[model samples]
Target: GSFWINAHIEAGKFLWQRSNKTLDSNTRLRTTGQPGDLDSPGDCLSLLVSEDDLEYYPGLPYNPHDCSDNQHYPLCERILQDTQQLLKDPLLVLEETISINIAKMENNVHLILDTIDKSISAH
Candidate 1:
């Protein structure tokens, strides 16, 4: 979710820079922009870690029934354990994805800068 959101944000920033002819060496790696800047928007992290959303998907130990039925309890418990384990570090995957996306964006920025350098040299 955060990965997609960040990707969209980065893509938007790249496009904005390209359209406005602002993709220069001075452009910094910024997730958020200063007030009045072209990319200045609201917080992205708040969208990632929403308290209200977390309340609906609370995992583990809170299961009220616990699948009391004997036949299904084993399977149910296993599922619960798996979910608990996942919940323990839910953000790990998101963090990794975000890291990868940022790396990709950095690479893209480098490529764009190199192209600009080459074009200016040719002129």
Candidate 2:
């Protein structure tokens, strides 16, 4: 389950009245999942996202997928207490993740240039 997720209905309920928690029962709303039965393999929460979803529902965060599935990568939000203790630098995380893809793109560009150079040299 996610940070605010729970098995009970009360846990899913959002407190509209910020001041009072239990007393303000009238001002409350349940943040339930999409209209469906609990038929998934596990109850863990995940965002159901796909490439096609970009055109229709861009930046919409309502979809939930299997939490345990390795195919889906989770986006983490955390306040850093100590930057030195961090295993990976938060600033370079995006760059590191796409480094391999960037290298492949560079290699492809080099190969294309080499092919063009060979064609000119042969001529």
Q: Which candidate is the best by lDDT?
A: 2
Quantify how close model 1 is to the true structure by its C-alpha RMSD in Å: 23.6
What are the C-alpha RMSDs, in order, of all predicted structures? Answer: 23.6, 17.7
Worst 10 residues of 1 by lDDT: 1-10
lDDT of 2 by residue, 54-112 (tens): 34555543333443445544444322225344645764786776997899999999999
Summarize candidate 1's per-residue lDDT along 1-123 as a digit string, tens digits.
111111111322322211333222123323223322433222121122235434543331111111222322221112233566687676888898999999999999999999999999999
lDDT of 1 at 106: 100
Error of 2 at 40 (Å): 40
Give one clash count per candidate, in the order shown: 0, 2
Best by TM-score: 1
- C-alpha lDDT values of all predictions: 0.36, 0.41
